[model samples]
Target: MVGGMHQRKAEMARHSDCFIALPGGYGTLEELLEVITWAQLGIHEKPVGLLNVDGYYNYLLTFIDKAVDDGFIRPSQRHIFVSAPNAKELVQKLEEYVPVQDGGVAKLNWTVEIEQPPPPPTPASKQVGFPALKKAEIAL
Candidate 1:
C-alpha cells in the first residue's frame, strides 16, 4: 500500500542499505534528498544513484552542480547522487558507493516551498481584438 512521506522515511530508516532513484517527480526527489541528508549527517550510510533514462536527470544534475557552485551544497556532497544515463552504470555506482565523512552542514533557518512564476496580467479589457474578416475577401 502507498504511504505518506513519514511512512516512507520510516521505511528508508529501516532499510538503510541501498536505494535507487529512477526518473520520478516530487516525491522521488524528496526521498532521495532526505536520504542524502541523513548520509551527510552520518545518520545512515547507503548508496544512492540516478537512472537517468533518456537524459531525464540531465537538468537535475546541472542544478546539483549549481548547488555546489552556489555553496548551498558541498562538492563532496555531490557524490551522494550518482548519475548514469543507463541502468548498468547506475547499478554499478550504487554497488560501489563508499560513504565517507561529509564534513559539516550548517543549519540554515529556512522554509521549503515550491515556487512558480505568476501568470501575466490580462489587458485592460481585451482592447486588442483580431481583425474582422471581410466577406468579399473570404475564400471557401
Candidate 2:
C-alpha cells in the first residue's frame, strides 16, 4: 500500500490512463491541476477531464478562459482537458479524447522528479481486475 498522499498520487499516475475530477475542496483541485500540468509537461499522455456537477466548476473554467484571453496561457493549451456535467458524458469525452501534441508550450522533461518504478507484471493466469477496460479512471 502507499504511504502518504504523495505516494498514492505517484501510484495513481502510474496506473491511470485518464483522469476525471469531481466537485470538492482544495485537494481535488490540486490533483486535477497537477495531472493537467503533467500533460502539459509531456510527463504523461493521459487525457484529463472534469465532472462539473451543477456548474460547480464554472468559475474555474471562466478563470482559465480569462487566462487564455490575457495571454497567460496559450489558446491551444487552454483546451488541455474536457469538462462535462456527468459521468457518462465525461467518459464519452475521455474515449474521444486526444492528447495535445503541439500546444506550443515546451514539453518539459520532468522524468527524474516524478518517475516511479513500474509494478511487476502479473502472470497471465493470475490476471485480476479488468484486463481491458473499454474505458478510464476518475481522479477523485
Candidate 3:
C-alpha cells in the first residue's frame, strides 16, 4: 500500500532484484539516475543497467563520459551501471554487474545494508517480452 510516488519507488527498489528503466522521458531518466546514485552511495548493490536500443542513449552515454572527463562525475562512479543494445545482452550485463564501492556524495534518511547480489543469471533467465523493446532507452 504505497501511497506516494517516491514511496512507491522506494518500495519497488527494495523488492526488485534489478532495475530496468524503459525508453521514456524525464521520469525514466530520473529513476535511472536515482538508482545509480544509490549504488554510488553504497546504499544498495542491485544491478543497474541501461538497455540502449538503437543508440537512443548514445548521446546520453557520451555526455556521461564527458562529465567524467570534466570532473563533474568522479571516474570511480562512472561504471556504476552497465548498458547493452538488446534485452538479452542487457540482462547478461546486469547479471554480471558488480556494485561500485564509492563513498557517496549525498546522505539519506535511512540506512540499508546492501545485500549480496544473487547468483549469476542462468541460461533460463527471463529474457522474454523484450523484442519490442529493441528501440528503447533504458536504465537498470
Query: Which candidate ranks first by TM-score, i.e. highest?
Result: 2
The full ranking of all candidates by TM-score, starting with the best, is 2, 3, 1
List model 2 lDDT by residue over 1-140, tens digit each: 85568668867988888888999999999999998888887878888999999999999999999999999888887778999999999999999988888856666654345547768777874776873563354322
In model 2, residue pairs whose N, Cα or C atoms come closer than 3 Å (at least 3 residues apart or on different chains), thus clashing, are none
lDDT of 3 by residue, 57-138 (tens): 8888999999999999999788899989999999999989887766656545444444455799986686766655664645
Alpha-carbon shift of residue 22 in model 3 (angstroms) = 2.0
Give the TM-score (vs. native) of candidate 3: 0.72
TM per prediction: 0.66, 0.73, 0.72
Write candidate 1's Cα lDDT for 50-105 as tens digits: 88899998888899899999999888888865778888888888888887565675
TM-score of 1: 0.66
Q: Which candidate's lDDT is highest?
A: 2
The list of candidate 3 runs beyond 4 A from truth reads 104-140
Each model's C-alpha lDDT? Answer: 0.73, 0.84, 0.82
Global fold similarity of model 2 (TM-score): 0.73
* CA lDDT, candidate 2, residue 22: 90
